[model samples]
Target: MAKKKYDYSPNDFVVYPAHGVGKVVSIETQEIAGFELEMFVIAFEKDKMTLRVPTNKAEEVGMRSLASTDVVADCMKTLRGKAKVKKAMWSRRAQEYEQKINSGDLIAIAEVVRDLHRADDQREQSYSERQLYEAALERLTREFAAVGNGNELEAGTEITDTLQSRVSAA
Candidate 1:
C-alpha cells in the first residue's frame, strides 16, 4: 500500500464521525489474504472504546484531524448566533439534531447546541429533547475542551454560560 499522504501521529486527536473525538493510539499492520493492511488505532477515552480505521480509508470514513482554529472560532460564533428552531414536530427536529451531532462537522454541531439550549426562564425541555441537547452539548464540549486545553466540565460550563447569555440577550 502506498504511504498515506498525511499520517496521524500517536498523540494526535482526531474526529471520527459517529464517535466524536478520539486519540490516535498507534498504527498497526495485519496480513490479510497475503496483503499487509495498515490501520490507525484510535482510542475514545470517554466511551472506553477503540476503533481501527484503515489509513487509506480515513477520509472516506470521515475520520479527520481536529477542527482548525478558524473553524473552531466559527463554531463559537455559531453559538452566539440566534437560534433557528423550526416550528416542526419534535420527532423530526430530534432526528435532524442527531444527524448534525453525528456529522462531525463543528459548525453543524454548534447549530445543534444553539437550537437546543434553554434560557433560565424558558420552558423545560422534554425528556427526549433534554437527551438530545445533552448529547449535542457533550459532543461540542469535548471538541472545545480538546482544542482549548481545558477539561470537559470547564469547557462545558463556559460554553453553556455563553449560550445562556446569548439566548437571554436575544
Candidate 2:
C-alpha cells in the first residue's frame, strides 16, 4: 500500500468526521491477516473513548487536522449570522442537522448551532431539538477548544455568549 500523505504526530488534535476532536495518543503497528498495518490511536477526551484508525485510511475516512485560524474565525462569524431554519417537517430537519454535525465542517456545524439556539425569552426547545442543538454545540465547541487554546467548557461558554450577544444585538 502507498503511504498516506498526511503527517499527524502524537498529541496532535485531529477531527474525525463522525467523532469530532480527538488527540493522537500514539501510532501503533499491528499484524492482521499477515499484513502489517500502521494505525493512529486517537483519544476523545470528552467521550472517554479511543479509536484506532488505519494510517493508510485516514484521508479516506475524513480524518483531518484541526481547522486553521481563518476557518475557525469564519465559523464564529457563521454563528453570528441569522438562523435559517427551514419550514420542513421536524424529522427531515433533524436528519439534516445530524448530517451537518457529523460532517466535521466547522461552518456547517455553526449553522446548526445558530438555527437551533434558543434565546432566554424564546419558548423551550423540544427534546429532540435540544438533543441536536447540544450535539452540534458539543461538536463545534470541541473544535473551538482544540484551536482556541482552551478547554471544552470554556470554549462552549464563549460560543454561547457570542450567540446570545448576537441575538440581543439583532
Candidate 3:
C-alpha cells in the first residue's frame, strides 16, 4: 500500500464549521462494510465531544486548520467596522446570524458579533437576540484564542474590548 498524505496530523487544532475549534487527536484506519477507511478523530474540549471525520471528506465537511494571524487581523478590522443591521424581521435576521456563525468564516462571524452587539448604554437585546450574540461571540473567540495562542477568556476580553472601544469612539 502507498503512503497516504493528510492535511492534518495528531494534536493539531482544527475548526469544524458547525462546531468551532477542536484538536485532531489522531488518524485511524477502520474497516466498515468490509472496506478500510481512514478517519480523523477530533476532540472538542469545551463541548466535551469527539468527532470522527473521514480523511477524504474533511474539506468537504468544511473542516479546516485555524486561521492565520493575517486572517485574525482582518476579523478584528471587521469588528471595528460599522454594523450593518437590516430592516428585516427578527426571525429572518436571527436565521442570518445563525448561518454566519456556522459558516466558520472568521470575518463573517465577526460581522455577526459586531452587528448584534449592544453597547452598555444601548437597549438590552431580546432573549433570542442575546442568544445569537452569545453564540457568535463564542465561535469567534474560540477560533481567535486558538490562532492567537491564548485562552478563550483572554480572547473574549480582547474582542469585547475592541468592540467597546469602537462603540466609545462612535
Candidate 4:
C-alpha cells in the first residue's frame, strides 16, 4: 500500500469513517502476521473504543482530520438544503442511505440525517428507519462535536435541531 499524505501526526484528532472522531494516542510499530507494521492507535474516548489503522491504509479507510470551521460550516449548510428524497423502493433507499453514512463524509451524513428526520407532527418512523437515522445522527454528531470542541450531547442537539428545522420547513 502507498504511504498516506497527511499533515497530522500522533495525538491529533481525526474522524474515522463509520466510527466518528478519535484521538491518535500513539504511533507504534507492531509485529502482526510476521511482519512489522507501522500503525496509529487512535482512542475514541466518547465510545470507549480504540482503532489501530495501518499507516498506509489510513487514507483508504477514510481517516481524516477534523474539518476546518469553514468546511464544517459548509457541511452544516448541507443539512439545511433541500432533501433529495428519492422515489425508490425502501430497500434501495436504505442501502443508499447506509452507504452515505458509512462514507464518513460529514456533508453526506448530514444529508441522511436531514432526509430521515421527521418532525413532531410527522408520522412515526419504522423501527429500522429509526435505527438507521440514529446511527447516522450519532455518527455526524460525534464528528461535529470534535470540530466544535463540545461534548456529544451538545453537538447532537445542535445538529439535530438544525436538520429538523430545515426538514420541517419543507
| Colliding residue pairs in candidate 1 | none
TM-score, prediction 3: 0.97
Task: Provide C-alpha RMSD values for all models, in order.
Answer: 1.9, 2.2, 1.0, 3.2
| lDDT by residue for model 2 (1-170), tens | 78554479999999999999999999999999999999999999889999999999999898999999999889889999999999999999999999999998888999999999999899999999999999999989888988988687889888999899999998
> Would you give me the overall lDDT of model 2?
0.92
> Model 2 TM-score?
0.93
**Ranking of predictions according to TM-score:** 3, 2, 1, 4
Candidate 3 stretches with Cα past 4 Å from truth are none
Question: For residues 11-121, could you state the per-residue lDDT of candidate 3 as single tens digits?
Answer: 999999999999999999999999899999999998999999999999999999999999999999999999899999999999999998999888999999999999989
For model 1, state the Cα shift of residue 8 in Å: 0.9
Better of 1 and 2 by TM-score: 2
Backbone N/Cα/C clashes per model: 0, 0, 0, 0
Q: For model 3, give the 10-residue run with minimal summed lDDT.
A: 143-152
Tens digits of lDDT, candidate 1, 25-48: 999987879988888999999899
lDDT for 43 in candidate 2 is 98
TM-score of 4: 0.89
- What ranking emerges by lDDT with the best candidate at the front? 3, 2, 1, 4
